[model samples]
Target chain A: NAGLTDVREAVAGSLSAESGVKLSADHVVMVCGAAGGLNITLKALLDPDEEVIVFSPFFVEYLFYSDNHGGKTVIVPTHEDFSLNFNELRKALSPKTKAVIINSPNNPTGVVYSRAMLTELAEVLRQHTSDTGNPVYLISDDPYKKIVFDGVETPNIMELYENSIYITSHSKDLALPGERIGYVAVHPKCADAESLMSGLIFCNRVLGFVNAPALIQRAVKNVQDVSVDAEMYRKKRDFLYGELTRIGYSVVKPQGAFYLFPKSPIKDEVAFVQKLAEKKVLVVPGRGFGSPGYFRISYCVPDKVLEGSIHGFENAFSEAMK
Target chain B: NAGLTDVREAVAGSLSAESGVKLSADHVVMVCGAAGGLNITLKALLDPDEEVIVFSPFFVEYLFYSDNHGGKTVIVPTHEDFSLNFNELRKALSPKTKAVIINSPNNPTGVVYSRAMLTELAEVLRQHTSDTGNPVYLISDDPYKKIVFDGVETPNIMELYENSIYITSHSKDLALPGERIGYVAVHPKCADAESLMSGLIFCNRVLGFVNAPALIQRAVKNVQDVSVDAEMYRKKRDFLYGELTRIGYSVVKPQGAFYLFPKSPIKDEVAFVQKLAEKKVLVVPGRGFGSPGYFRISYCVPDKVLEGSIHGFENAFSEAMK
Candidate 1:
């Protein structure tokens, strides 16, 4: 009853094909979600005061996950374009650095890191490990793996970094956020991959997950191929992104996922979000993601809701400008 | 996505009525199962090296649960009848004593602790708390609460102690072990009950459970009032107990749960279990639960299997006696 056998292998097969990252059944650890997978992986890898480097304005939960397992999270601010600032990332690395967690088709900004960026990061990690003898793992979370727009390619990070872990769920892909089902794929070439897999399974139990939900595991296998209407989300993103940029709100074009981050019209994102709330617009302050002076708008809602919120966004922006 | 609103409140109400404990919605925290609830509660309440006292021949997972959260599990041997020895328990308690985890309709022995024993233990705890100024939480895991035979009453430890935390799963009662749905109910009268409830919910998320399975949570509410087939199990228990005792085996008449524990005619219970396995009769050695010279037989299978296995149990017991 720990986990259904076919579903675990099914998840492995599904991920190997979807990710282009070769994996065996032993490599796939089914989890509650990307959140579940990430936390389990972190618990397995981290000791007290161990450093996990995460980019700022990252999914805020990453910090919570690390801290929950006694790992210290080191946050590096991203560039204005929301690309990996490798120079800053390199400066953040040290002997204490245990892993770097990256979310592609990222949550708030929807900025997908290309293969080139990943390969460069891998190279940086390899050099540092060679110099300091402290290996740093690359943990890639891709809940929005299938939600890319404009034909963006999300690199199989495992292919670039031998010490990579691919964590994801079908929450975004299958429109099943409430299900909380996902997996952790340990890279075959990762250092001590077998040991890492064992630790992950042990942590999965001791950390109280015991295993991923049984029914959802079975359900996932049956509907692994069922695709959500990503185009609908794409349409929503395009409309919302256009509206923000059209009114002189500086916002990056989202490459994937269903969220767009725009610079607040005022310096105080909290105050600006409050101003928007007054217009019945609900945007999260960037401070929630450790990046203030910006606001996040999620388009993963009803079309009518998105349509109705347009006026709120415009009104809030105009009022902030005044 | 976090939890079903009604499920937590429903669990609180259900347990309150069943156990005669006073609990509100805030007192109940839904979890994946007793395993999930236990681990989260341990993580919240235990600091490194704190002691959680468990009676020997207890549920084996209790040790693992304590160790998972850096707590030391101190095992106290049970009385010959598998009852709690208050004297031994009193000796086990110290300034470092944090919790006492007990399972009634016990896992291996199936000895349901009476209300009197629970009250005595509660008084011991109250005196210890008064003298040492440290609260000792009584953690009662009641997965088999509804499985008791012969009309035995499973004491609600919350009614016995203010600091009690009841951890349970509906797997046994609802026959839904595969679903992994359960909850933790913080005692309303407990000191820091509010903080404990908050810690439990936080631990549920950060420990990678996120929440109990959403579908199971909903399903539990619908079938919460469904009756368990206690008679079917009682019939199996009676037959199994009769056959073993008739064959000159020393077996206790199990008052609850689906298991029967019989003293091995041989001092080596592990070897006795192995002998039974040789005849294709599966039984677990009590050594696994910290009580050697005994083995646990589960009557959870069909009656046909139980009938067919009678020869194996008799043959093994006779051989061990020789």
Candidate 2:
């Protein structure tokens, strides 16, 4: 019942149709949250020592979730500019590689993986599966699917990869992180689709989200089309990015999601976060995201909170420089 | 967040007041569900190989929950009528016993423990604690707390036992089973109360509920005073009990909850369930509830479902006799 509820199926189905693909309810596995979705999918695909290739500076929970299910993480670090690192990715791929996890409108870096990049990634996975004599699933951690600006089309990985699974939630899109509702939809064309569905259901039960909260499953179904105000996030992103850069901090300009990953003026990102705490600006260290020398500022806070912190950031930056 | 949302605490607090216990925010540990609450309490209190005692004909999940946390269940069979067998209980206690699980308006049986029985049981727990080195925790599973019949009082175990942790949920009471919302509350007087709170919170997060579903937490908070109609359950129980008894079945009349456990006319309860199922009347075997020669009929269905099944039950009973 968790995220694979009837309503979630409807949402995923509608979304799939909009992308010009046919999807069925059998493909949907409701989950507790995006974490739940990830855990469930990993549980479905992983055997002991099976490896999942992750693009680093990834959402760190992926490591924990994968380990929880006995899978080893094969980290493929992105480039200096935080773009797709195909060279590193190709090196990471192996016969034991069971999956590759992609977070488009990525967390930490907030770089949306371009269509060409996604297509290439899918091609790699398809080729690797054929070459290795086993399937390597493509998992899209896509909580920020609808949060991108400029009306760019996000690549449907399920469309391009025959062995793709989509994991998403209303946590970011509908701004319901605490609701603990989301879904895992396997591409119907995925190899051994029925086994995947069974594994997902077992994972959902054993991982302890008996089902998603029922009413929210229905409530989210009603609001699947309703989206968060991306303009608000864009403004916050602009303000934070400009302010941090003006203060001589290096950072990737986030393309989607509500976070700015700015390089720390100090060598230790954790210490930098501690110093920001001293300035009463709470931010998470990039070390937690597997990328030191950077820290992330969540832009999801109300404008007033961010506006009030502008002075704090400026003063902290000046003091740190001193 | 699984069930850690403040709103879920508020709802749990409001509902705890139904038993005359005024719960503050600190009292509620929002959970994955009641199962999560029970498992959390066990994890908090039990060390590896610690023992938990339970009366037989208990909920099956108790076995898995206790074992999951390295607690062994010491089973003490109840009286022939499924009431507490005090004599058997007195012999079951050991130094390794960390807790005793009690369910009322009991599952699979629907027998509400009388106030005198609960008082006497509390005394037994107290005496056991005194005889042993540490106080034994009383774990009360009271999902059917609000469902009672003929204006009977279901003694609040928390009121009777100071060292009790009460695990209850809105699933049964509010008919919101899919919501996966519930709470675990430690009595203020429990030993090492603060540590217990920490353990519960730790368990909550470690179990991956992270917190309860947020909207249901808020929804329950809003409708804490509302309850499903117990009168309907009472009527169904009465009708089902009467029909079975009239057909020469020996049954203990259920005083609360939405189930009726009746002695089978045949020795094998499994066969009885199969016979009933043949008549298109589904019922669980008593063996599943830690007893044989008796079967449980969940009367949660509407009156029409019950009334329509009367002739069916009659026919099944007659055929079994033949």
Candidate 3:
């Protein structure tokens, strides 16, 4: 338990320092999982009927998390091909909007916003905060921070927004989802730093997580520098992406994270997912992520499974076309 | 993942069994922790400005939990010796009351409510619910159920109140708190059972527990009948209780659980707690628990530590009297 806390603190500290960010030890609230981190943050930040802005094709749980706390989620859906849509985001902003969530190398779509996009988003956020006189916090849900494939690099949000709070976990990076441990690091320079820290600590305790699991907190702290073998996931992503494109399926190549968000060969995603399940392919429908006609395929399975599913993918495509 | 779902279902099944009580499994909802259960219950059942009655010397977090969700807590102070005060409870209730929290084998003050008292309390709850139109939920937080001493039996809240929901964990019972595993078992007989379960499931997911730790859920299933060595706590409780009493400190003999709520040999509890800390004994002040002029000593530590603290307690008592 001791070791895990040390490792987590060290990693969080190193990350904050490397980005020239500032946060006291108290601002770092460790949790059971990134999912826990998300829940805790929402619990602390949201009050009834307040709004949190999430980009489109976002994780479905974001909607649930926000709604549970009586917060409305304003979705600024990304461009049709799944890139950041700043024009749409500007339209989504309002005085009641409490926060904006950015997931880079994100879930489903797997698009990484360039630094230029982030710089512009920050400028817009600053202007919005000034205009509304209500600061809109940035929640960077970056569980896939280090799961990049090829040569893609994801920028840290703390560098872009002083009010940013980063939530990440080792579920993907260390393959420790079963372990359920992670932390929330708030940049010390954020507005109302003390209130923010207290809200987070109170949220952590009141939300039913007094602290992270003592033993796993120490375990992750011990193996802070160590990471999961993502090579296997990278290989699975490559194999599936290759086979789907070959079979005439349209997909945006996964830049990072172990998921493929491929446009359905047919326009109806729910029906497409049902047909795929018939072929024993258990992909989650993208309609759940707020986008129809696209579906998410998790590539976290083994290499042999991906290789074996190639023929199944081809068959699903043929049946759909006919 | 499979084990977690099974454990959840098992907990659900436990709630549904005909305990010969009025409630069925419909009342039970799996939660992140008892804390999560408390907040969700408060959120679901409470309307703005509604009152929640809590027995004083209750868990301090109860106040924070209730307030955060928009309910006000009406504290009914316990008797001089920290036993139930039924008259006070009768006076405290109003039509706006949402629920009452009863922690038997109570924390800080380890006085277990007698069966007679519990039955009387049940009658109070039933009458209040009938008269109010809004059913008053009885939330029994039971992390210390198996941590009692002697031949005492902890009364089942489900047996007493048809509207009761029990939240418990292996944390204290199995000494697995760092594991963050627990359940919320609602009696299915509660009013609006289906909606309650739906709210609970949403609360569990939205609160960020997603589900309990999958592996620990499996591990706990194997140890349902296993318990922490009660004799160890019994011995320590006896030693500390005896030593404090002999040293001129008055205390209610603990019937269950591992805490000794000793009356401050002196009246100033904050000062007393600070002085004890000076002597390297860490006891929370009674003021923290909504009762002054008394403080708590956690007897959960090893016997050797309790033995070593005997002289410390003696010296502290002597110094306080001066």
Candidate 4:
């Protein structure tokens, strides 16, 4: 139930090498995917009506996953640049707070939280724990950890906090989302880490996942260090970023992942998305991610498709501005 | 997500051929396994505090699976020969009863329900559904459907009842438990079948499964008719059954699967199990399956191991009788 030992050992070695923290196979539990990892982690940590905190412009499914285990979601807004807003997070921390989920290189927004930022966040959580006499768990969802552009490194949450759980998947890195394979790494120094691991293993079965798919577990063990070339995504990102910005659409440069979240020319992003769809260009409304007045464009398509959408993007932006 | 279209079509065709019912891809929902199928089905059918009926000497996980979806389990005892007891089932039905789960060729007992028996059970459920104005779903868990012995055929529940859901996994028949792949087939004639299927698909994602693993789904699509050799399991069953009964253990002649549930020599089956363990023979106490005074022996091991355990079985039986 914890997982196949050799697969867990390989993941432990890989995470340890990247995080500079000593980890063992005993701390790792294989899961269906990042979705599966989050579900099991929440199930292990939550009692009824306990709260979980998430930054605004978050993965929409985070709300559903928390609710699945009877945990309420508390949304805290990030800064304009999608950086951690510590004031908001500090206010969001209450005795009912069981966990805080951080995703970087984030989904929808593509902003990667820096090490200095994480250290400050950890300090705030530590102070809250001491003040309230309740432990706050940091859950880092890192499916895009290997898809970062430039030389930016995703700092491991385990090294940043004592009571943290690190989860990741092969979906974005290996481009195997349909395969549904991932793992959860519990910090060795986590509060009640042993019991948490046992609970995760127990929930994995009772929740009907049983274990991660066996064929993928065997297939991915040897390829732990391999990932799809980020340059391809980088090229696609550059093309869409350049085209959308040149077309007079206000956009922030994405550091990682394959998304570009740009402010909508109009206040209602959903209306703008419908206009773009009429022009044969598709993008998700930011309201879907809990932030309105903005929209998300996924740049993981072929070059021809991205190039072809340029005309539609230009027409939609010009019409919206007019 | 519903799943890959081609895979669903393949499964639909295979089920149609086997059950002689006209099924389409729209009626099928791919799942992680039989466990995944059951969870989604129960989640879709159950409201809070509703009841799901199961037979005694059942798979232990049925209780947890039912409770996972806010449903309570009401166990109906089977007859002395491990057949369906209609009187207990009739007495157990209530306005709160939302579903009835049947597993055949059953676990622990390996008792396969004949087509005539299933017809009678369906009639009883239909009468109950009419008596109380609430629909009762029949969920057939058929992981061991293809493992029947002595040329006995297992009836498909979809053909037997209008409000039936048929779930099967490649885990047992294809001998691929670790692969974690299966599908749920909702009878097209089921009450509100379209809405039920939509709920199942929604629950499949929200429950953290998302979909069945991609590799196995693709692989099994072409081999739906293939299964492990039931004769091999039959040989092992024969060896264990012949030897145990010859040594004065009262055992049932199994018609399917690979289990033998025998009356324990002593009234306390747990103590009998411990004695057997001391003699290097291991069998599960019947209390684990909601039945007592009998123990279960699984004969799916290699022939050499079955042969080697005979002496232990003999010694344990003699000591218990003395």
Candidate 1 regions off by >4 Å?
Answer: none
Higher-lDDT candidate of 1 and 2: 1
Label model 4 with its docking quality class.
medium
Residue lDDT tens for model 2, A70-137: 68998888988888888888888999999889898988887888888888888877888889899999
Task: Tell me how many residue pairs clash in candidate 4.
Answer: 0
lDDT of 4 at B91: 93
Q: How would you encode candidate 4's per-residue C-alpha lDDT over A252-320 as one tens digit per residue?
A: 888899999999999999999999999999899999999999999998888899899999998888898
lDDT of each: 0.85, 0.81, 0.79, 0.91
Q: What is the TM-score of chain A in candidate 2?
A: 0.95
* Local accuracy of candidate 2 as per-residue lDDT tens digits, B1-322: 2254567466546646755666567767877678768876887788878999988898877886776566799999999778899999889888888999999989988988999999999999899888886889988898898888898998777778888888888889888877788778777778887889888887666545667776666667777677799988887887788888999888899788888888888999898889888889998998887888888888888778889888878998899899
Better of 2 and 3 by DockQ: 3
lDDT of 3 by residue, A39-79 (tens): 77877787779999998899988987787566898988888
Question: What is the iRMSD of the candidate numbered 4?
Answer: 1.1
> Highest lDDT: which candidate?
4
lDDT of 3 at B257: 83
Candidate 3 docking category?
medium
Candidate 1 at A174: error in angstroms?
1.1
Best by TM-score: 4
Give the alpha carbon lDDT tens digit for every residue of B16-65 in model 4: 98878899999999999998899989988988899999998998999988
The regions of model 2 sitting more than 4 angstroms off are A2-9, A18-21, A42-55, A63-76, A84-100, A123-135, A202-208, B1-23, B39-55, B63-76, B85-100, B119-136, B202-207, B222-226
